[model samples]
Target chain A: MGPDETAGHYLVANVPRARRGQTVAEVLSQLIAHAHDCMDVVCVLDDDERLVGVLTLAALFALERDRRLGDAVQPGFPKVHATTDQERVASLALHHAISAIPVVDAKGKLLGVVPSAALMHILRREHVEDLHRFAGIARETTLAREAIEAPPLRRLRHRLPWLLLGLAGSMLATLIMSRFEGALAIDPAIAFFVPGLVYLADAIGTQTEAVAVRGLSLSHARMRTIIGGEARTGVLIGLVMGGLTFPAVWLVFGSVHLAVAVAVALVVAGGIATTVGLVLPWLLGRFGSDPAYGSGPMSTIIQDLLTLLTYFVVVSLIVG
Target chain B: MGPDETAGHYLVANVPRARRGQTVAEVLSQLIAHAHDCMDVVCVLDDDERLVGVLTLAALFALERDRRLGDAVQPGFPKVHATTDQERVASLALHHAISAIPVVDAKGKLLGVVPSAALMHILRREHVEDLHRFAGIARETTLAREAIEAPPLRRLRHRLPWLLLGLAGSMLATLIMSRFEGALAIDPAIAFFVPGLVYLADAIGTQTEAVAVRGLSLSHARMRTIIGGEARTGVLIGLVMGGLTFPAVWLVFGSVHLAVAVAVALVVAGGIATTVGLVLPWLLGRFGSDPAYGSGPMSTIIQDLLTLLTYFVVVSLIVG
Candidate 1:
C-alpha cells in the first residue's frame, strides 16, 4: 500500500489498552485514568507488548469485576497489519461487525486501532474516488462537494485529459470509418447505423463495468467462472435486443439484408463488449492499478472500436 | 421515504435510555443490569417520554458519579425523524461525526437509534446502488457480488430494459441520420466524424453527470450557481477539444470547410452536453427520482441525438 493509504496512517495509538493479567476492575480504573481516542475495543497485550486478544467494551462491561482480562478477552479476533490497505481495513471492520480495527506489526506487537470515524471516512472517500474514476476524472477530488464546486478551470483540468485521450481514440474511430468508405458509398444507409450501434455497445459494456469494478475486488469466484457467466449474459442480452431490432430496421428501411447485418452485428458486439468490460478490470487489478480505472472513456473507446469493426464485417457479409 | 428505506426500519429501540433525574452512578448501574444493542450513546428523555438530550458513553464515563444526567446531557444533538430517508440518516451521522443517529417521531418521542453497523452497511449499499443506477441497471441488486454472480438469464433480465430503451433511442438516431442523407451524399467524408463527435460529447457529458449525481444531493449551493458554473466548464472543455481537432481534421481531409464544420459542431455539442448532463439529473432529483438515473444510457442517448442534429446543422451550413 502507498504510505498515505495504509492502515498505519489511519490508526490511533491512544486507544484503551490493557495487560491480560489485569482484573476487570483494574482495567476499568486504568481506562478511567487516561483519555483515549477510541474506546470501542480494548487491546490485550502480553509482557512483550504483543497483542494477544481483543475485548469489546460491552463484553468487558459484562464481565465480573474480579474476572481477569485474560479470561474475558476473545482470542482469534480479526486484525490487520499496519501496511494493510485502508479499504481492506474498512472491509474487515464491516465483516467482523466491529466499528474499529486493530493494527499490528509483523511481530504481532500492538500498534493502534483504526478508529470508527476514520473507517467511515475511508469508506466515503473510496466511494467518491471510485465514482470519479468511473467517470474518467483525472485525479481523486476526495469529496463530491469539491468535485462539483471547484472553479470551472480547475474542473476542466481534471476532466480534459480523458476527453483528449478520447479525441485520439476518436481519430482511430475515424480511420476505421474511412476503411468502410467503399461500403458507405455503395449504400448510404450504412452510415446511419454507426451511432446507434456504437451507443448500444457502449451502453451494454458500461453495465458490465459497473458490476465488475467493485465485484472483482470482493468476489471470491474464479476468473473463468465469472468471465463465462458474463459472456453468456452478454450474448443473451444481445440476442433479445437484436431480435427486437431486426424487424424494426427491416420495416423502416425496407431491406432484409441490412436488418440481418445490423442484428448479427449487435449480437457479436454485445459479446465482445461484456468480455472486454470484465477482462480490462481484471487485468488492471492484476497489474496493481485500480480496477475502477478500467471503465469510463478508455474501455468505452475500446468497445466502440470493436463494435465498429464487428458491424462493418457483418455488413460486408450480409448486406453484400 | 418508502417504508423499507426509512430510518425507522433500521433503528434499534431496545437501547440504553435514561431519565434526566438519574445520577451517573445510577445510569451506570442501570446499563450493567440490562443488555442494549447499541451503547455508543445514552438517550436522555423527559416526563412526557420525549427525547431531550444525548450523552456519549465516553462523556458518561468521564463524569463524576454524583453528576445528574440532565446536567451532563447535550441538548440540540443531531438527529433524524423516523421517516427520514436512509441516505439522509447516514449523511446526518457523517456530518455530525457520530457513530449512531437517534430517530424520533413527530412528537419528539424516541423511536430508536440507527447503530454504527447499520450506518456502514447503508453507506456501502447506497454506493453499489448508485453505481448500478448510473449504469442503467433495471433494478437495485444491492450487492456487487450479486450483480456479477447472478445466472445469465437473470442477469439479462436485470440489464435488458435499458438496452431496449437504448434500442428505441437508436432508431431515433437512425431517423435523424436518414434526414442527413442529403448531406452525406454531398460529401462521404461527413460520416467519418459521426462516431468521434458523438463520443466526445458523451464523454464530456458523463463528467458533469458524475459530479452532479451525489453533488446535487450534498451541495448547499443554489441550482442557478451550479448550472452556470457547469455551462462555462462544458463550453470551455469543448473549445479546447475542438481547437485540437480543427487542425487535425483540416490537414487529414484537406477540406477546410469540413474541418470548420466539425470543430464548430463540436463546440456547440459540448455546451449542449454539459447543460443536459447537469440539468437532467437536477430535474430527476426535483421529481424525486435518483439523480443517478439521469446518467448512463438515458442521458447518453439524449446527448447523442442533440450532437447528431448539431453536426448535421453545421454541415448543412458550412460544408454546403
Candidate 2:
C-alpha cells in the first residue's frame, strides 16, 4: 500500500476518546483536558479499545452533566480502517456530513482520527490534482499557485510528456487519413469536413470524459446505467447538431447527398464519442489508474481517429 | 455580489468565544457548555464582539487551567470580509493552513465563522464546477454523483449548447477548408493532415488553457513573464512535434517539399495554439469571468480553425 493508504499518516493521535460508562461530566472534563486540534467528536471505545460509537461535542454538552457517555453516543457513525485511502477518507467525511473521520485498525481498535484540517487539505489538493491531470500535466503540482509560480523549464518538463504522447497519436491520425486518400480523391469535399467532424466529435467525447472521471469515483449507480445514460445523451446531442447541420450543409454545398452524409456521420460519431469517453475512463479506473488519466489529449486523438474513419465511411456510403 | 460572495452563506454563527480577561478554566467551562457542531476553534471577541484573537481547543487544553485566555490567544490569523468569494475564502483557509476562517464585517466585528465542514464542501463543489464548465456542461451539478445520475434529456439539455456552438464553429471550419479548395486540389495529400494538424494544435492549446486558468487566479507573476513563458513552452513543443513530423511525412510520401509544408505548419500551429490558449483564459479572467470558461470546446474549436488556416496557408506558400 502507498503511504497515503496508511491511516496513521493523516491521523491525529491525541484527540479525546472515551469509554461508554464514563459520566458526561467526567468525560467532558477529560475531553477539555485532553482534546487535540480540531477535536469536534469524541470516539467511544469498547473494553478492547474497539470503536463502538461517536458523540458530537454538541450532543454531549446538551446532555445532563451526570449522564453516561454511552447514552450520548450515536452508533454507526462513519469510521475507516487505518489503511484506507485518503480520498476515501475525505469522501466518507463528506457523505456523513462530518468534519472529521475516525480511523481504526484491522481488529477494529481505535487508531486515531483524521482531523478536519487534514480533510480540508485533502479536498483542495485533490481538486488541483484533477485539474492538472485533465490538462495532461504529468508531474503533480497540487496548487494553482504552484503551477503559476513553477519555473518555465519545470513547466515544460511537466507538460511535455502528454504532448509527446499526443504527437505519436497525431502520427497515427495522419496514417489513418492517408489510408482514406482514395476517398478524398473521389471528392475533396470529404476533406473539407475532416477538421470539423473531428472537432465536434472530440468536443462531445471530452464532456463525457469529464463527467465520467469524477462521477465514476463517487457514483454508486451500476456501470450499465451510467454508460447507457451517457450514450443516450451523446446521441441526443448529435441529433440536434446533425439536424442543424443537414440543412446548412445542403444550402452551402447544393448537394443533398453530401449533406445527408455529414449529418448521418455526426450522429454516428456522437454516439461513438460518448461511448468511447465513458468506456476509456471506466477501463482506466478498473485497472486502478485514475479515470481522469483517460480523459485528455491521448484519448482525444484516439477519438479523433475513430471519428475520422466513421465520417469517411459514411460519406463513401451516402455521397458516393 | 453573488450569494457565494457573502461570508454569511457558509458561516456557522454559534461557537464558543472568549473575553480578553477570562482565565483558561473559565473559558474552557463556557466552551464545553456551549460548544456547537464543529467547534474546533474559539474566537476571542471583545465586549462589542469585535475581533481580538483565536485559541484552538487543543492549545486551550494544554495551557495552565488558571491562565488568562488573552495571553494564550494567537494573533494575525486569516480573516475575510462578508462579501468575499467562497473560492477566495477557501483559498485563504488553505493558504493559512487553518480549518476555520473567521468572517468579520467592515468594523472588525466577528459575524461568524466559516467552519471546516463548509470549507471542505466549498472546495469539492468548486472542483466539480470547474470540471463541468471545462467540459461545457452549463448547469451546475454540485456533486459528481449528481452528474452521473442526471437524466439523459437533462444531460442533453445541459451539454448541447456547447456542441451546437461547436457545430457552428465546425461549419466555419468547413468554409475555411472550402476556401482552400484550390490548394487541396493541387495536392490532395495536404488534406491528409487537416485532422491531425488541428487535433494536435487543439491539444497543445488546451494544456496552456488549463495552466492559465488556474495560474491567473493565484499567481502574483507579471503578465509579461507568464505569457512569455507559455509562448516559449508552446514553441518548444511545436519544434519537437514539427521536427518529428517532417521526417515521417518525408519518408512516407517521399516528397521533401510536401513534408516541409506539413512540418512548418505544425511548428506554426503549435506556436499559435499555446498563445491563443494562454491569452483566451487570461482575457476571460481580466473581464471578470472564470478563466476556465475559455479552456473548453469553444476555445478548442477556435484553435482548430486557426490551425486549419495556418496549415493551408503554410502548405499554399510551400507547395503551391
Candidate 3:
C-alpha cells in the first residue's frame, strides 16, 4: 500500500485495539498514547471478541485527579449487536443520539466494536449501491466487468402468480369498462383517467412501503405501533391527495363521471396501499422472510390489480 | 408513570455518566479505587459543562498503569459534536470500529460519552420495527407519544407531483387504448393479457427494488459488486419464468399471433421492468431524491401506459 493507504489502514486497525481490555487506567493510557498518534476513538469488545461497546478519550479525562481507575468502571451500560445491518445500526444510533455501537452475535456475544466512522462509511457505501440497483444495472457488473446479468428465469417464477391474479382482476376491470362502454363510446374521455387512478393507488402503496421499511428500523417499539402509524399516514396522504387530484381529472377530461371514479379510487387506494405496504413486511417477518423484499414489486403488482378492481367496481356501481 | 412505564423509561435513561473537570489520574484513581462498580466508560467534558470527547475505561486503565497522566490530558483528540446527527456519528464510529464516542457542543466543547451498548439496543429495536413497517403500519401510532414526531404534511408535497404525473400518464394510456379500438373490437382476449403483462413488469420491479433498497444497508463495495449480480439473478428468474409460462400461453391462446405477442411482451416487459426497476433509483438519486421509492405507483402507471402503447402498436402492425 502507498503511504497514505498504509497510514489510514493502520489507523483503522490500531484505534480499535487501543480500546480493548477496557478499564479506566487502561483506557487513559491508550488515549494518552493515541493522543500523540491522533486517533479519535477506540473500540470496546466483549469476551467473544464481538463489538460490545465504545470508549472515547474525553470520557476518560472526567474523573478527579485523585480518582482511582477502578472507580470509573460503572455497571449497567446498554449493549449492541455486532451482526446488525450497519445502516439500520447507524440510523438507530442517530435516533437515540449515540456515538458508538457494540457488535454482538445473535446470541449476544460481543465480537468487536463498530464505531461511528465505520458505520458512516458503510451507510454511504450501501446508499450508493442502492442507487445503482434502483437503476436496474446489475450491481456487481462493475465498470470493470461491463457484463450485465441477463434477467433471471427464476424471477419470472416469483412474478407469474401475482401477474395471473392481476389477469383475473383485469377481467373484472374489463367488466367495469363494458359497463361504461356506452359512455366510453359517447365521449371516450372517461377512459383517459383509468391509468392515473391505478397509478395513484399503486403510488400510495409504494410510499407506504417506503415508510413501513423506515419504521422497521425501530427497536424500542412493537411492529404494530410502527405499522399503524404508517397506515394512518398513508390514509391521510390518500385523503388529501384524492381530494386535490380528482377535480383536476374532471377539468382535464371534462367527465364528472371519470373524476368521481378517479377520486374514489385514489382515496381508497391510499388506505389500501398503505395497509398492504405495512402488512407485507409484518407477514414476511412473521414467516421468517426478509421484510425488505415485501415492499417492492409484489406489493405494487397486487395493489395494481386490487386498485383496478376497486376503481372499476366503484365506477360500475355508480354509473351502471 | 406505572412501574413498567417507569422501568422502561429508566432503561432508556440509564446511560452512564462521568463527572466534569477531572484529570486522567483522578479518574483512574476512582475507577481503580472502585473496580467493583463496573465503570466501563467515561465522559470528558469542558469547563462550560459541554461535552468534547470520550475516554474509555480501558484506555484509562492502560494510561493509569503507565502513569501517563500528562500525555493523556492533551487537547489534540478529535472533539465529538453534540449537535451532530446520531446516525452520522454512529456510522462514523462504526467505520473506525471504536467502542466509545464523545459528544460536544457547537462551540467545540465536550458533552458526554456514548458507549457501544446504546447502539446495539437500538439495532434490535429497529429490526423489529422494520418487520412491522414492511407489513404496512405506522410505528409510532401505538408507541408512546414521545417516541414519534408528528407526521408532517410537508412530505405530501413530494408525493403530489408524482400523482399528478401518474394522472397524465394514465390519460395517455387511455388514449393509447382508444387508438387500439379496432384491435379490441376484433377480440377482447388481447385485453386479458394487458393486466397480466403489467403485473409481470410490476413484480419484477418489486424484486429489483427490494434488492436495491436492502443493498443500502450493506457496504459500498459489497453493494456495487452485488448490483449486477442481483440484476443477473433477476434476469435468470425472468427467463426461467418466461420459459415456463410461454408454452402454456401458446397452448391456451392458440393463435400464433397472440401467442407470439404474449411471449414477446412477457420477455420484453420482464427485461424492461427489471432494468427500469434498477435504473430509476440511480436516476432519482442523481437528482438527490430517495431511490427507495423505486417501486412507486408512478412507475407502474407509466409502465402500464408504455405496455399498453407497445402492445397496441405491435399488434396493430402485425395483425391489423
Candidate 4:
C-alpha cells in the first residue's frame, strides 16, 4: 500500500469501546459517557486492546442489565484495514445494513469507526459529483447550492472545457458530413433526417451513459449482463421508434427508399449508441478516472458522429 | 388539519423521551432501557407530552453525572410535522448537518425522531430516482442492482415511452426539414452543419437541464438569479463556439454565406437552449412533477426541433 492509502484519515477515532468482562449496565454507562455523536454500535476490546466483537446500542438497550457485555456481542461483523477507501467503507455499510463500519490496524486493534453520518455524507457527495461530471461541469464547489449560485464567469470556466472538446468533435462531425456530400447531391432529402437521426441516437446514448455511470460503480452485476441488457433494450427502442417512423416518412415524403433508409439507420444507430455509452464509461472507470467523466457531452459527440455515419451509409445503400 | 395528516407514517416513534428533572445518569440509564435503533437524539417532553428541547446522546454523555438532564438539552432544534414529504425531511437533515430530525404533532407534541440511517436511505433513494428519471427509464426497481439486472423486456417497456415521444418529435423534425426543401435546393452545403448544430445545442441544453433539475430543488437562491446567470453562460458559450466555427466553416466549405449562417444559428440556438432547459424543468416542478422529468429524452427532441428551426431560419436569411 502507498503512504497515502491510510484509512485512519477518514476514520472517526472517538468511537465507544468496552472490555469483555464489563456488565451490560456498566458498559452502557461508560459508552454513553465516552461516545461521539454517531455512536450507534459499541466495539468490544480484549485486554490487548484488540477488537473481538461488536453490538448495536439498540440490542444492548434491550438486554437485561445483569447480563455480561460479552454475551451480547454479535459475531462475524466485518472489519476493514485502516487503508480502505471511503467507497469501500460506504459499500460495506450498505451491504451489511449497518450504520457504522469499524476501522482496524495491522495488529487487529481497533482504530475507530466510520460513523453513519460520515458514510451518508460520502454517499451524497459522490452522488452530486457524479451528476455534475456527467453534466460536463467541472464543478466550482462541492456543494450543489454553491455550484448553482456560482458567478457566470466561474460557471463558464467550469463548463467550457467539455464544450471546447465538443467544439473539436463538432468540427469532426462537419468533416464527416462533408464526406457524405455525394449522397446529399444524389438525394437532397437524405440531408433532411441528419439532425433528427443524430439527436435521437444522442438521446439514446445519454440515457445509457446515465445508467452506466453510476451503475458500473455501485452494482454488483456483471458487465456482460448490463451490456447485453442495455443493447437489447436499445435494439427494442430502435425497432418500435423506427417501425413507426418508416410509414410516417413514406406517407409524408412519398419515397419508400428514403423511409427504408431512415428505419435501417435508426435500428443501427440505436444499437451502436447503447454500446458506445456503456463502453466509454466502463473504460474510464477501468482507467481510474470517474466513469461519469466519459458521459454526457463526450458521449453525445461520439454518438452523433456514429449516427451520422450510419445514416449516410444506409441512405447510400438503399437510396442508390 | 385533515385526519390523514398524521405524523406517525414518517415518524420513528420509538425514540426515548425524558422529563425535565432527571439526573444525567438516570436519564442515560432510562434512555438505554427504552430507546430504539434511532436513539441518537433524546427528546425532552413537558408534562403534557409537548416537545420542549432535544439533546444528542453524545451531548448527554459528556454532561457531568450530577448535572440535570434539562441542563444538557440543546435549544432551537428544528422540528417538522409528520405529514412532511421525505424530501423535505432529508433536506432538513442535510441543511442542519445533523443526523436526525424530530417530528412533531400540530399541537407541538413530540411524535418521533427520523434517524440518520433513515435520512441516509432517503437521500440515496432520491438520488437514484433522479438519475433514473433523467435517463428516461421508468425504473422497475428502486435498487440499482435490480435495475441493472432487470429483464430486457421490462427495461424496454420502461424506456420506450420516452423514445416514442422522441419518434414523434423526429417526424416533426423531418416535416420541418421538408419545409426547407428550397433552402437545400439552393445550396446543399447548408445541410452539412445540421447534425453538428443539433448535437451541440442538445449538449448545451442538457448541461443546463442537469444543473436546473437539482439546483432548483436544493438551492434557496432566487429563481431569476439562477435563470439570468444560466442565460448569460449560454450566450457566452454560444459566442465562443460560434466565433470559432465561423472561420472554420468558411475555410472548409469555401462559402462565406453558409459559414455566417451556421455561426449566427449557433449563437441563437445556444441562448434558446439554455432558456428552454432552465424554464422547462422549472415549469414542470411548479406543476408538481419532478423537475428531472422535463430533461433527457423529452428535452432532447424539443431542443432538436428548435435548433433545426434556428439553423434553417439563419441559413435562408443568409443564403437567399
Candidate 5:
C-alpha cells in the first residue's frame, strides 16, 4: 500500500489495553505477562469492545492496585479518528499535553494508539515541511539532510515551480513600472525607493505571515477580531517605519516632497502588507489547504505589487 | 532560579532508575512500589553512580524476569549534558529516535532525563521560534495566540527591531540605486527589472536559508561539499529562471541588450543568493549563535544588496 498521511498510518495496534472491570493489579499482571509496542498509555475498553477511556502509565502506576480500572480511566481523554491528518494528530497531542493519542474508527471501536515515537516523528516532519513550504519549496523533504544534499536538478525541480510563478508576478511588476515611465522621466529620484519600499513591505508582511501561518489554526478568536487587530498592527508598524524614513530621505536627498511621498507610501504599504498576510493564510485555511501554502512567494509577489502601486500613487500626488 | 533555556531546566530527577546488578523482576517490583515522573526508560547506573546504559520499558517488558538489568541495558543510548540548549536536546532526541534523553553531568553521573513531554514542548516551541526569527521577529512568543493577540504596541516591540534593521538595509539599497542613476538615465527600462530581479534573488536565497538553518546542525557533510552543492543549485535555478525571462523580456520590450542584462544579472544573483544563504547560517553556527539568526531579515538584506549590485553592473555593461 502507498504511504498514507493519516493517524491510521502511525497507529500501533499492539498497545496495552485493559477491560474496565479488571482490577489495577490484574491489569498490571497482564501488562507484565505480555509485550506491547506502546506502554505509555493503556486504552480502556467497554464490554462491547468500544473504547471507553485512557489511563496513562504514570496514573496507572500511582493507582491503588485493588481499585478497578474503570475508576482509574481518564474519561473524555483526547482521541482522533483514523483519517485525521498527521499534523492534527501531533497538534492534538500538544494541545492535550499527552504523549500518546488513541485512534478510533467511525463506529467508536478502538483501533490503536498513535505511539509517542510516532508523535515525535510527526511533529518533526511537519516542522521541516512547514519551513520548506514557507521558503517556497514545492515539495517537502522528510529530512533536513535530504533537503540540502539533494542533487541540484532535484532541488531545482522542487524550487522552480514557485519561482516560475514569482517570475510571472515580477513581469506584472515590470508592466506596472513601464506604465510609470513618464514619472521616472520627470524625476529619476522616485525610482530610488522602489527596492527599499518593496523590501520593507515584504519584510513587514512576512512577519505577519509567520505569525498567521500556524496561528490561524491555533487561534480561536473570531475572524473579524483577528483581522482588526492585525490591520491596526500593520498601520502602527507602517506609521513608525514611515516616520523613521521621512526625515532621513528628506535630509539625504534634500527634498521634502519626496520624503513625504516615501513616508506616506510606507504607512499605506504597511497596512496593506499586514492585511494581505493575515487574510491570505486565513483564506487558504478556509479552503482546506495548509495555511502555509498561502505564504512565501505567492503573498510576497502580491505584497510587492501592492507596495509598488502604493508608492507610485503617493509619489504621483506628492512629487508630481 | 531564573528560567534557564537548558536541558537542566527540563530535567526530571524522579525518573525510573536501577542498579546494574538488579534483575528485571526486581526492578519491575521496585518500579511498581514507587512513582516516577518519567518511566519510558530505566537508567542503569554503576556502583559509582555513573550511568552505564538505558533500558526501554518495551525491552524491559520483553526480557526474562530473571535477567539482570545490565544484560538488558542498551549501552551508549543517546544522552545530553545538563547544560545543553533546549533546542539541541530536542534535536538529539529526534536524531536518536528516543523519546526521553538522559541528561548527565561532566563526570558522567546521570542528573535526570528530559522526559518525552518536555521534548515535545521543546520541538513545538522551537518551531515557532525559528519561524518568527526567519520572518525577522525580534522576540520569540511562546504561544501563537499571544503572537497574534498582543496589543499593537506590544507586537511592534517584538517585531520592530528587525524591521528597523531592515529599514537601514533598505536605505543602503536606496543608496546603491542612487549611484546607478547614470545607468537608469541611459534607459528607463533598466529600472523596470530592478524589483523583479531583486525579488527573484531574494526568493532563491530564502530557499537555501530555510534548508541551511536546520541542515547545518543535522548534516555531517563537509562545509565545502554543502556550499559547492548549493552554489551549483543556485546557478542551475538562475539559468532556468534567466533563460525563461530572456525570451519574455526580448519579445515584450524588443530590447535584446536589456533582456541579456536582466538574464545575466539573474544568473549571477542566483549564485550569490544561494551562497549567502548557506554561508550566513553556517557562520552563525560557527560563532555559537543559532544558525536561524543568520536567516530572516539579516541574510535577506545581504542577498538584496548583492543582487542590486549585480543587476546594476550588468545593466551598466549591457543596457548602458
Candidate 6:
C-alpha cells in the first residue's frame, strides 16, 4: 500500500472477485466463508492471473440478496492500486457512507486496503484542526517538528507584494474614510464600527470561502452543488446574524444611526461575503489552485474594501 | 444522525450487522468465494459470539499470510456499529486498511454492513469542508445537513464574548497605536512597516497555524515533530516571499532604509510567526478546543499587539 511512513498506518481494503466469469454462487460462498478474519481479504483474479476486487462480508450479503446464488458478477465494483493516497481512499469511503471501499489502480488491479480505523482518527483530527485553523489559530504542539523544513517557510515570507496589494486595497478604505470624514467630524461615533464592520465582513467571507474550498477538494463532493446552495444559506444566515448583531451594536456603541448603518452593512456584507466567498473558491478551484489559500487574501481584501465602501454608502443613505 | 437540523431534527443512521464468530477458514472461504458482494456480511465468535473479528477479503488474506489457518481471531479486523457516523465509519475503514468493517450493537451483535465506498464520500466532503472552514469560510449549502452542523459559523456567531475579548486585545494595539502616534509622527517611515511586520508575523503564524491545527486534528500528521520542519519551511517560504516583496516596497517607498526595515520585519516576523504559529495550535488543541477558529482572533490579536510592541522596540534598538 502507498504510505508516507511505516508506523501507524494499517488498512483492509475490499476487492471484488467477479472477474473471469466467476459465478454468483462461487463468489457468495467465498464471501460468506471469509466474513470472519483478522484483516480484510480480497479475491485475486487473472487478466492473465493478476489481481482484481476486494471481497468483504457486507458485499457478499448485498449481492446475495439481489442475485441469489449464481448471478454473473455485475459491474461497478471498485478496483484498487498501491499508489493511491490513504487520505483520498478514506474520503471516498466517507462520502459513500460505506464501512469499507476498494482501492483501485490505473489498470484496474487490486491493491491493499485503507481500513476505517486508520482513517477515522485522522479525519476527526483533521476536522478539529481545520476548525481551529479556519478560526485562525494553532491546535497542538505535541506534533510539532524539532526542525521544520526551510523550503516552504522561505517561499512564504513575502511582505511587499501582499502589503502593497493589501495597501492598495486598504488605501481604498482611506478614500472611503475621507468621503465619510464629515460624518465622523460631526460625530466620531461613525468610525467606531468602521473597523468592526469591516472585520465582521472579513470574518464572514473567510467562513464561506473556507467551506467552499474544502467542499471542492473532495473528488466526490460536487463543486456546483456547493456553489448553488451558498447564496440561499448566506441570506438566511445573514438575516439571523444581522438581526442579532445590530441590536448588539446599538447597545454597545450607543448609536441608533450607526447601528442601523451597521445593520444594513451586515445584511449586504453578509450576502456579499457569502457570494464572494463561494464564488472565489469556485474560481480558484476552476483554476486548479488551492482554493483554500487562493480565496483567503482576495476575499479579505474585497470584503474589507467593499464593507468600508458599503458602510459609507449606507451612512450617506441614512444620515446624509 | 444526531443532528442540528432545525435545532432538533434527526435522521436515523444505517444499522450494520454485528459480528458472529467463525473460524479463520470460514472467513477465508467467503473471500475466495463471493468477493463481489462481501459488504453485507458480518463475522463474530462461533462459541461465546464475542465478535472476535470482522470478516472481509482483505483481512482474511492478511491473516492467512501471517498465520496458519488455526490462529484465533485477534485484533486488526474491521468493526463498526449501526449508530456509527456514516462518515466516520468510512474513514475508519480506510485508515485501518480494511475493506469492510463489521457493525455491532452496544452489546456487540452484528447489525448490517456499510461498505467503504458508501461512508467515505461523506467523510471526504466533511473533511475538505472543515479544512476550508479552517481558513475561516462557511460550508456550502447543497451538501447534506450533517456536513455543516455545529460548524464554524454556529460557533463563531457565538463568539461575541471572544470577539470582545479579542477586541480588548486589539484595543491593546489601538492603545499602542495611540501612544505611539507620537513616535509615528516622528517618523511615519517606522509606521510604514509596523502593519507590514505585524501582518507578516500574522501571515506566517497563519500558515503555521493552518498546518499545525490540521496536523493536530488528524492524528496522522504531527505538529510537534513538524515544528522545526515548519520553521525551516517558513524560512524558505520567507526567503521567497520576502524576496518578492523587498523590491516592491523599495519601488513604492523609494527608500532603501524602508526597504531594509521591511526586510528585517519579514525575517523576524517569519521566524516568530513560525514559532508562535506552531505553539498556539498545540496549546489550543491540548485544551481540547478546535484549534482552527481558536487561533484566528486570539493569535492575531496577540500577534498584532506584540508585533507593534516589537515594532517600537526594534525601532528603539535601531534608532534610539
Best by DockQ: 5
The DockQ values of the predictions, listed in order, are: 0.72, 0.71, 0.13, 0.65, 0.81, 0.18
Q: How are the candidates ranked when ordered by lDDT, highest leading?
A: 5, 1, 2, 4, 6, 3
Give lDDT tens digits, candidate 6, residues B201-296.
555565566555545544544555556666666566456555666687668657665566556656655566776777776787678654554565
Between candidates 2 and 4, name the one with more favorable DockQ.
2
- Regions of candidate 3 where Cα sits further than 4 Å from its true position: A1-54, A69-76, A80-194, A219-232, A240-255, A286-288, B1-149, B152-155, B205-242, B250-254, B274-302
> Which residue ranges in model 4 land beyond 4 Å of their true spot?
A1-9, A32-37, B1-10
Q: In candidate 5, what are the lDDT values of residues B271-320, reduced to their tens digit? A: 99999999988888788777886377888899889999988887787754
Would you list the C-alpha lDDT of every candidate in the order shown?
0.85, 0.80, 0.51, 0.78, 0.86, 0.52
Residue B92 lDDT in candidate 3: 49
Better of 1 and 4 by lDDT: 1
CAPRI-wise, candidate 6 is incorrect
Ranking 2 against 4 by lDDT, winner: 2
Give me the displacement of residue A135 in model 3, in angstroms. 11
Real A-B contacts recovered, model 5? 0.75
- B-chain TM-score, every candidate? 0.96, 0.94, 0.61, 0.92, 0.96, 0.65
What tens-digit string does per-residue lDDT give for candidate 5 at A1-320? 12477999998899888998999899988999999887878899989878899977878888899999887776668899988999889998888888899998898889999888788888887778778988888755757889899999899898889999999989999998999998888778889999998888889998999899878888888999988898899999999999999999999999998998899889988889999999988888888788887377788999999999988887788766
Q: Relative to the unseen true structure, what is the C-alpha lDDT of residue B273 in candidate 4, on a scale of 0 to 100?
A: 84
Tens-digit per-residue lDDT, A194-299, candidate 1: 9998888888998999899888888899999999999999999889988988998899899998998899889988898999999998888899887887377788
In model 3, the Cα lDDT at residue A306 comes to: 70
The candidate that wins on TM-score is: 5
lDDT of 3 at A117: 47
Could you tell me which residue pairs clash in candidate 1? none
Worst 10 residues of 3 chain B by lDDT: B4-13
**Candidate 4 residues A236-318, lDDT tens each?**
87888889889988987789998998898899888889888988888877887767774777887888898888888777777
TM-scores, in order shown?
Answer: 0.96, 0.96, 0.59, 0.94, 0.97, 0.60
